[model samples]
Every structure is written in structure tokens, then in C-alpha cells.
Target: MAGGGRGGTGWSSLPADLLLAIFALLSSDADRVRFRAVCAAWATAAAAWCPRPWLVGSRTDRSGRGGGTVSSFWLFRPAGAGAALLRPFAATVPEGLDYLSSSRGYLALADPSVSPKAVVLVNPVTGRRVRLPPIGFFKRWLDVTTVVLSADPGGAAEWAAVAVGFPTTSLAYYSSAAGAWARLDFAAPGYAGVEHYSGRFYVAFGSRICALEADGDAPAVIPLERVDDDGADGSDDEPKLPGGSGRRVVETHLVECDGQLLLVSVHDDVVYSSDDDMGGLAVDEGGSKGGGDARAVEVHRVEWLWDGLVRLVRETDLGRNALFLGRNRAFALSAAEFPACRVNCVYLVDRQGHPDGVVRVLDLENPWACREETICPDDATGGSASSAGWARRGWFFPNY
Candidate 1:
């Protein structure tokens, strides 16, 4: 009735509060951007509300291989099947860039075509990019296992970026305030994973958890104590490393949920074959071709004890949050926020060389009830059941 006078009511006639509420329900960043473009009032309201996160997918070639010229990307709504292909800013993201990791809406990319590989951070939403020193700066390390950011580069005045490699003997970190990459002196030969939480960097080396400051000072190492070990039950069938080897190959992940740090341990078994290339060696105990298929995953909540030591508090169940762990980045989403997502579950992309690009959902409460779904369907990625498709893929979170 407010704008009922001549040519019916228009979107601009809507009240500011009502427009803010309606825009808040929009889960897509593109939709929110269009909403703000409607009029001046709508734009003002939309600028105040925080938008929900979106799951982004990189466009692969028809063959589903990892690195090629990527002209466009895809966005998937967390709550529904709505997806859209988006073109990134030209200067920010160049052609033939391979995505490695994502944090706070920024992507860490590598250009394989260049000598000594070029690494840069890209924010697609803001069209901002910052190129770091070449990968060779990190002591000529060919591959970086994980990269994490201390703050969003788009909004923060100062930020820190950490790049770690497998069999890590030291860490290479970049601080915006210093405008240079500095090496953190530490020896972690069996480094499993690294994560940034609570203004500190945490690393998992073998079975030990160590904490370091963002600038790489004040180190504290903690050993994890398992409460439910089979040895404690006096069982002779205690689990041991594969092939009766005393040393075990484990995959570790550090995640932050509800303002708490969580350590996830995934047991892996390494298999050696004379005919196979060392680059394609399998890391999982399941004898799979890749390390993507984890045999067992255990989650533990980190607790700071009174004796100035850190201990792991095992969590039997996750209440409403579901975790998604990829090759480098990890995400925690609550079912209450997105009803379509399952609670107490872990979702991961197919690592077993499956052509279908299947995503596996593991239910922590009922481990035997695991399920698999195809994300890059045949029609989406242009891959058949037999073709080796989309070798390199990752999850992206867009914040605008």
C-alpha cells in the first residue's frame, strides 16, 4: 500500500529494514550484489549485513586434468543445487593458474608454466592480487603441502601467510608489515599439517602438537595421549604399523570450530612398488593409488592444561557442525545454518583416481554408513565414466 499509488509497487519502494531482511536471506554473493544494485536504499541496507559463505569450484578441462587455462569458475550454494559459472577479474587471476589453497575468500595459486613456479594470492570478489616471492625462495621446495592465512588480505592492514612443505624442516612466512618472506627456524622432519588459530600457528609433527606465534617465536610442543588405546585394555590385537614396521605414516589436520582448535589424525600406510613412479606412490593403508582414501580419522579437541602443557580432549560426537577437509583447506559448517548439509559428517573430494569426481561423506557417529555423491557430474565437467578427469580440485569460500 505504500507504493500502491500509480504503477504498482516497485522494489525501491520497499522499506529499508524489510529490504535488509530479504537480502540477508540471499545465500549467493552474486544475488546479493545484484540486490545492492537495485537502488540506493537497498545498497545501504545490504552493506550492513554479513553474507553467508559460498562453496566455489574451479573449472577443469574436458579431460579433467589438474592444470590448464581456467577461464571461468563455478559457485555452488551450500543449501541448494543452485550453481553459476563466474568469470574472475582479468588482471587478478591469469590464465593457466593452478589453485593450491584457500583461506578467508582468497586463493593461493601457482603458475606451472613458469620456471621456479610463481605463487600468488587472489581475491576474486575484490579483484585484488598480491604476488609473493617465487617458490624457490623457500629453499627451492618444489611443493608446498599447506598454506594458511592469519587474516583476510582484502580488509586487513597487515596479514601473515605461512607456506609449509612435506617433511618440513622449517617454515616460510610472509608478513605484510615487513613486505618480505622470512624463514622460521624449526626442525619438523615429519610435519603432517599446519593451521592458524587464535593468533597462533599450530603444527602437527608425527604425534606431537606444537604451537608458534604468527611471527615464528615462542614455541611450545605437546604430545598427544590417547585414552582409549587397545594396549590399555590388555588386548594382544593392538594396532601396529603396516608390514610390521615400527614407524607409521600419519596424516594430520588442524581445524578451528566454535572458537576451539581440533586436531584430526588420519592413519595411513605406505606401499612401495618397484615399477611405480615415486611421484604417484600411495600414502593410505588401503593400498589406493593416492593418499586421499584415509583408513581411519580421529578428532581431538585441544586443551591447555594447568601445568603449562597442551593435551588432546577426544570428542566422541560433533553436535551440529559438519567438517569438510580438502587437500589443503578445511571448513566447518553448521547444519543449523544450511539445512541441506548433514550434521556430524565429513565431506571430501575423491582422491582414489575416480573419473566420476565423487565426493565421499563420512558419518562420524556411524562410520559404516558412509555415502558417496558426484559433484562434477558428467554433464558439468564434460567427463565420461572412463576418462581421467579433473586431477586438481579444491573448495573455495567467497566473502564480499
Candidate 2:
């Protein structure tokens, strides 16, 4: 009866408002495309809707000689039910380009195999690529950790692509206005993460956070201060280790959500497992066969005061947004836009030794409500060996 009208009984007879409401409920781009094909009215309604974020999967082809060829990147629409299929773009992502980070619907990639390797910013949707000036050092020696973009390179009037890693003077940046790459004097011996928020760059080193201006001067490091617990009883204490000591903060991620800078601290406890008769073998909890370390994650939001100091606002909640952290990129998206996504949650990827390509979803509201999903399913690539081989994995948000 929705489509019943004086003109006819076809879907075209449906009211424009009703068509738009139906299109807005569709979570998949492919489904929306099909809906748009239904009629011109439906197409107009679908075109006006905004797109949701995507989880990107990338695997390397190690079968080839002298390193391996980088496989095509896959996009998955994560829904409350599960991950749904979205069209794969960059099927032949340029050879040697290893995905490092993603920001504002663009991917920052680099080739670690070659010296003076090329670093590039690419938008898979638009197939637009911008190459940064080559670094004169080897990837191994430099130990470049993460690269972040000030804005989407494809459309920003003036943008900056910054790379941070080990060794002194390890901060390198490319500015569109300058049209070249320049090294910053800021030295972070143990750099952890970098983020661009509210027209300024914030870098995380160990437990400290610093704000970097555009002039390339030395930024002041601000140490994190503890705040009173927001528990129902107004207790300032948190769960401690067996020995009564507080959990060790291993890593920190800086992110901007809703116009505020936040810091997510990763905590862990080293639990050693010893096996009998296997020569007193020791292993980390939840670790793979050879080795692994188990960690308990605690994410916190930082509140910047008007007096120029910052404090740990809270650790138990993320409000209406969810965070994605990995490969030096940390982003927050509103849960309202993606009904399937959980609010106050963190979606993380493991980019280290394990190549399982598992994506873990951690709920901030309830730490125990963690879920793991694999990005590369066994049957995804038609039995290819590279099907489960991921050179890098990240979160890619499409611009509609």
C-alpha cells in the first residue's frame, strides 16, 4: 500500500519521503546503489545520504621472489550483525606501497623495501594519489612508526603529512603550502602516537603528550596527571596488580573526538607461563606458540584546562563515539551514524608479528565485552595463499 497511488502500483509511486526513509536505513553501499537503480526518485534520495566508515584489509603476496607483491585492498562494512561486503578498490595498489596509516578517507603508505622509499597519500574511492618527498634513510634503521595527515590531501587547501619514529630528529613532515618535506627538530626517543586536532599536531611519547605548532619549533611535553575516580562511591582507587602496584602503561594513542584531544593508554600485566618437561619453557598469556604478551587495555580521555594544563578526564566511557586505533592512526566516529557499531568502543588491529589479521573490538563501557573478528576470511580470495596474508590492516572511512 506504500506505493499505491493514482498513477500506478509500481515502486515509483511511493512517496519521496518514504523512499528516502528506506534508503537511509540501508547500511551497504552496494545495496544503496541497487536501490538508486530502482528509479530516479530513489537515486536522488540515496545520493543525499552520507556514507559510513569501512574496515580495510591488506595482504602481501610472499610467494614472489625478492619480497612479495602487495595484494589489493578490501573494504568491509562493519554492521551490528557482522561485516558486510563493500566494493574493493585499488585492486592493484601500486607495488611496494605498504599501508602505514589512514586519515580523513586517505591512506598513507610507504615502501620499506627500498631506500629513499616513496611515501604516498592515496584515496581509494577517487583513485587520487599524492607522493611525498622520499626519505633519505632506510626503513629498518629509521623505524618509522606512524604517519598522519592534517586533512584529506585530495581536497584540503593546505595540508601536512607527518611521519614520526625512532632516533633523534625523527619527525618529518610534508606541507602542501611549502610543497616539500622538512624535518622537525623535535626528538622523541620513544614515540608512541601522533594526531592532528583543532589546527595543531599532538604527539605522544611514553606517558607524555606534546602540542606542535606549524612553525616547527620544539613543543613542550605535558605529563599526564591522575584525577579522582568517577565511580559511584567516589573512590579514587582502581584495580591494581597482584602486588598492589598500579598497572604499567605500555603505549599511548592521541585522538581528537568532538573537538577535544584525548589520550588512550594501554596497560598490561606480565604473566609468565612455564611448561613442565618442555625444558622450563616460558610463554606470555594469550600469546602465540613461540611468544606473546597479554595486556589489559584502559582508554582515557584528556581534558585541556583553560590554564594550559591537561588532566585525565575519565577512562570508563567514550560517550556517543567509537575509536579505531592502529598503525599510527586513531579516529573516532559517531555511533549514531553506524547503527551496528557500539558506542564508547575501540576497534584495534594487530600489526606486529602475528599475521592473523584479527580485528578486536573493545567496549570501553565494559572491558570484558571484547570481541574478535578476522578481516581475511579463509574463503575470501578463492583459495589463494595470499588470502590471509595481510601486509597491513587499517580502518578506511569513505567520503560520499
Candidate 3:
């Protein structure tokens, strides 16, 4: 909010109450985060607001991981209305660690050299970090898909973290009270993604929804008789996913929105199978097949149908809410509340976990129809990557 008072400089330094009032009017998370970045006074004032976390995308310049390999990560707002009104959150990250997904405001980083997998949760905002116990002698080939937290480590001493990915039979979790990473092996078919909601972690598998209840070893898929438009519980009326141009379902995420549960499924023609598989990323030097890295995103509202039964109804209008969906703990933000986000849309981190991949925001048209929104960073042109290292990691909600 620039204004020409006192030689065009007073607007940046508004009183706390006035800034809080202005913060209330923003509908995008990015704008609110930028609001705090205005100056020292604003950041202090924002502690009173504790605004929602804005979406952050990273560009890891995978073109060459040559020498000393220190990567800098910048967390900015994810809004379709793309003028960075504030300073983006930035940090000079240490070398040898790759960014996994983010939770609360901490970046879940993986140290590959460690036997098995050890994730270090670092909050770039306050520089507070929690080193998770490395579980199992798991190899790097068995990649961990996404991670979610029950509470922020800075805000609470006890936190629970859940991660799911490759090999398909196991998920990893951390209980700060237990003080170690433990694996919860399961017998379910390929789990797509998991979301921590209502004190229970919900896991989505093939055509099924399951919830992890209270330190349980694994989640059991909830059987359901689909609820159709007629309000009848029947599987016959389950809506077809919004089909795209030969796009395949690469990732599925469960998130909480508008006080309800939402299932977000991402489809793409070009999937990044190997981030370490950088050789293939080079093949598509044409830039995500002319910026078509992610082709379609399908969102469904979860309808709990009493007694272990659930229905997934397709949601067409998200109203003021926009969602960030990927391997990370899925989350939704309101444009009416934050103003920096696009209303009724899905923000996608690149599939195949490419730090330097593309970020696509798909506008929700209807259950059966959706077109991509132009989601480019502020420094880029036409919502497309201007150069290399433009891949988006995921969304991180910042409190500090």
C-alpha cells in the first residue's frame, strides 16, 4: 500500500492498529506475509495478527549441482495477482540437504547421506529446528513423498509428523514425546497422500479413504456407499474426475478447507519421475512441454456418511478459498481473508519433486471442466519460468 504522504514514504510505516485493520482486509496469504515484511515495525505489529502462511516455491537450479552447492530458499505469497507487494521470506539454506515438503512454517529437509532417512524440520522464520530420528535402513530409491505436522514445533513442544511415499507399504511418523522416527508399515495398496485433520491423519489409497486414529499403527480405508446429488447413498452416482488431455493422476492430497475436508488430485502429462533423475528433466528443455507440466487438478469435498462410510463430492466453487496441493500436508487459504490468493483455485507444486520445476494454479471451472491459470512468479514473464531453478517446492504457513 503505497501512498504519497510526506514525500511518498508514510504509507509503509502505518500505526499498528491501522496495519492490523489493513491486514484484516487482505484476502491473500501472500499479501499478508508481505505486509509483515514491510519494515521492523510492521513485522512486530504482525505478531499480533499471526497471519496465515503464504505459498512458497523454490527454484533449485538443477541445471548443475556443481560444487559447494549452497541453495537459497525464498518463501513468497502464492497469488494470481502477482506483484510482490512486500519482501519475500528468504534464507541461505545449508548445503547437502534437499527440501521435501513443508508444514506449519518449517521446511522438512532430507539428509540423503544418512542411512535410512532423517528429516530435519527447519523454520526459516525463527531459525528453530527439530532433528527427527532417522527410521529404518531405507535406501534413497524409496523416496518419501510428503510430510505433515500435527503442531508447530515453535508453538508446541510436542508435535507429530507423518510421511508417506515409495515402496508403497510403509509410512513414517514422529512423536516429539516419543523422540524418534518410527515406521508404520501397512498392507494397503499404494497410498496417494495423507492429510492431518481433526486430530486424525487421513490417508488416500486407491479409490479409498482411511484415517489414522490416535497413534494407530496404520489407517484403515473407510468403506463408503457414495452419496449422489439426490442425497442417496450409492456408489453409482460418484462423479467422474475432470478429465484432461491424456493427463494421468500423479498425486492425490487430502486437505482441510472451509472447516470441511477436501481431496485434491493432480494430473499431468509430464511427470518428474526422478529429481535425481535429472537426465529426463533435461530432455524437456522446451519448458514443461510449453509450460504444460501440470495439466489438470481435480478437487473433491469429502462427505462423511456416518459409521465408517464416506462420499467424495466434486466441488466446483471454492468461494474465497484457494488450495495448495501436493505431497506436502495439503492446505487451503481464503482469498476473502488474505486477498493475495486466487479464489476457487488449486496451487500445485511441481510433480516429480523437481525444485526447479513449474508451479501451476488451476482455476476451478466445474467438476468436469477446469483450465489452468497463469501462475508465474513476479520476476518471470507470462506466468512461465523465465529461466532455470524456477520449480516450486510447496506451501509453508509462517507464524514467526
Candidate 4:
């Protein structure tokens, strides 16, 4: 008969390796840290497994300071024991322009006051920033700047940063490769959304949606007809209207989902896909022979892409009004509402609920509780009658 060690209740005699393995399964980083000090052997294992640095989610509202020049701001994250305040260290920034775009860990700054205004690229986390050469749009009918971060897998090892400006008269693009800004001699109506998708950059201003190829060169705008095709084929295609004519068109918004670029256009009640191709537009044999009109464009009639995004939306307990979209699985906050939690930095949870998904709030700090008015400026608060802003502004239940 083998002799067992003391505390035979089963924990004392367990090998250090076995004990460490059991502790490794714990998800809480705080819990993991405490377990390490239980023993020297345990500490060694804990250090290796707990190497992920905790990135604080605290962000300032660039639009909320000084006056109404900037609007209300909200900061949010997943709910859990880790839900703590996210504070920022002081930093310097240029005057006038707002921070319009962020990607590849950098923020795009545009100065609206200056003629041919200067657009500066900044990385707040690393404290590194750069100002690009000016664009000649001072006297023009308002030029808007948008920036996106992209990685060209088929080309450069480093990520590519693109800045696009649309003036009433023309359009232009800037790239880190040129190390300078240049003009794009084209016309677009007006873009409602711009973002980076799947290692490639995307733009949705006006009626047309465009993408840059992963090869890292100047990307061509996709004509309305071919907007659905993948970008793998290389053809020198110029943008054109539905009748292959030069008429301007535009969309209200665009979003990236499951590797595909989706656009919701204002012209027609349709939702078109770029098939995740860095390509511009696509067409079918039977439709869009005109090239610009959404000839057979896949349609989803919701005005906002978020409305048709059924996957992220879910029903909650509060008369099915509360809903939450989790990073892993969806959950509900109240009714058609999802409460923010403190698990990680997850502010952009759609109405969809998920396991890891959480809604983060800036002022209402606890991730494990709720307040009478979960939403700011809500109908309950004498603001707009619509509660949409309440959800969009990032409020959630405290899961921790």
C-alpha cells in the first residue's frame, strides 16, 4: 500500500505541476496573479502565463472639450472584476481640427480652420506622431479628411496608413509609402463612413464604395457595377455611373463583417458587398450593365447598417427591449438593452448579446451594477425622445 501525504483531502499531496495546471485555467488575471504567490513553483508558472499587459481603456472625448465644438463623449468596456477607470496621461495636440479617424494604433487629426488644412497622424499609445504636407483646399467648399490603417500582406511587412480628403472640387489620397500627400483627381458625392478592413483600407463617401488593393499602391475607386467582385483580378477599371456615364453617386454608411465590406447606400434601399475583396465594385451578367446603378446589388432596406445587422442584435429581459452584444456570446441587460461589464475594453457592443461582449461607460464606473437612468440624456432625462443615443453612447451592466 502506498502511503499518502498529510491533508489527504486531496490537495496537499498533489504535485506542484498539477496544481499549477489547474490554476492556469482561471480566466481572471487578478486571480492568476494571487495564485502565483501561493508557492515558488506556482509563481514561475504564473509569470509565464500572465504576460499580457493590461491596456487601460480610458479615452478622452476629443469632441467633448472646450465647448459644443465637440459633443458628448462616452467610454466603455466589458464588465468584470477588471472593470476599473481608464485614465489618460496628459499629451500635446495641435489646435482646431478634431480627431476624425483611428487605426493601426494611430489617430488622424484634421485642422478645419487653416486653408488647405493640415492633417496630422498620431499614435496616442506610443506617444509618436507626424504631420503630413498640406492639401490645397483652403478656399474650396470644405474638404473632409479621413484616415485608415491597413497591412498589405501581398506587399510590405509594415502597416500602411492612408489619408483621404474629399473637397467639393476634387479628391486626394496620402500614403506612408510616398511619405507625402498627393491629390486624387476625381469626384465623389460625400462619404458617411470610412474604415480599415481585413488588411486593406476602405472608404464610403458619396454613392460609391472603394477599397485599396493589398499590393500597397494607389488604389482605384470601384465603379458602381463591379462593387461586388473580389479584388484578386487586376484590371485597370475606372469608376463610372450606372449607365457607364460620369454621374456622381454616394452611400450613407458602410461596415465590415465576417471579412466582407458591406455598404448601405442612400440612393437605393440596398446593401452591397465587396466580397472582402480589396477590389472596388462588382457586377453580374444579367444586372448592372450600366456600371453605376446597383444593377442587382444585394439589397437590405434598413437605412442604417446597424439596423440590418441582425447577428449582433438580441432580445433582453426588459420586455425584450434590453439586448447586449458580447465579444464571444450575446447577453441582455434589461429590455432591448445590454448593460456594460468590466471584463475588457469593449465599448462598441451592438445591440447583439454575447458571452464576452460588454458595454462600457465613462462616468457610471461600476461594471457589476445599474443606475436608474442607464442612459444619459435619455427620455427619462428631458433629452431626445429616442433612446437610441442611450445605447449608442455605451452604457452597460456591471458583470463583475
Predicted structure 4, TM vs. truth: 0.41
Flag regions of model 3 displaced more than 4 Å: 1-15, 18-45, 48-89, 187-191, 216-248, 269-289, 351-356, 366-371, 376-392
TM, every model: 0.70, 0.70, 0.69, 0.41
lDDT (Cα, tens digit) per residue for candidate 2, span 220-288: 334334333342321222333324443555556788888777777554554323222112111123333
Cα lDDT computed for each candidate against the true fold: 0.58, 0.58, 0.59, 0.35
What residue pairs clash in candidate 2, if any at all? 59-390, 80-340
Displacement of the residue 92 alpha carbon in candidate 3, Å: 5.2
Which of 1 and 3 is ahead in TM-score?
1
Name the best candidate (by lDDT): 3
- Model 4's C-alpha root-mean-square deviation from the true structure amounts to 15.2
Residue-level lDDT of model 3, residues 95-194, one tens digit each, is 6666677887778776645556677888765567888877664443235657788888877867788876664576666778777666665544443678
Q: What is the lDDT of candidate 3?
A: 0.59
Write the candidate numbers in order of decreasing TM-score. 1, 2, 3, 4
Better of 3 and 4 by TM-score: 3
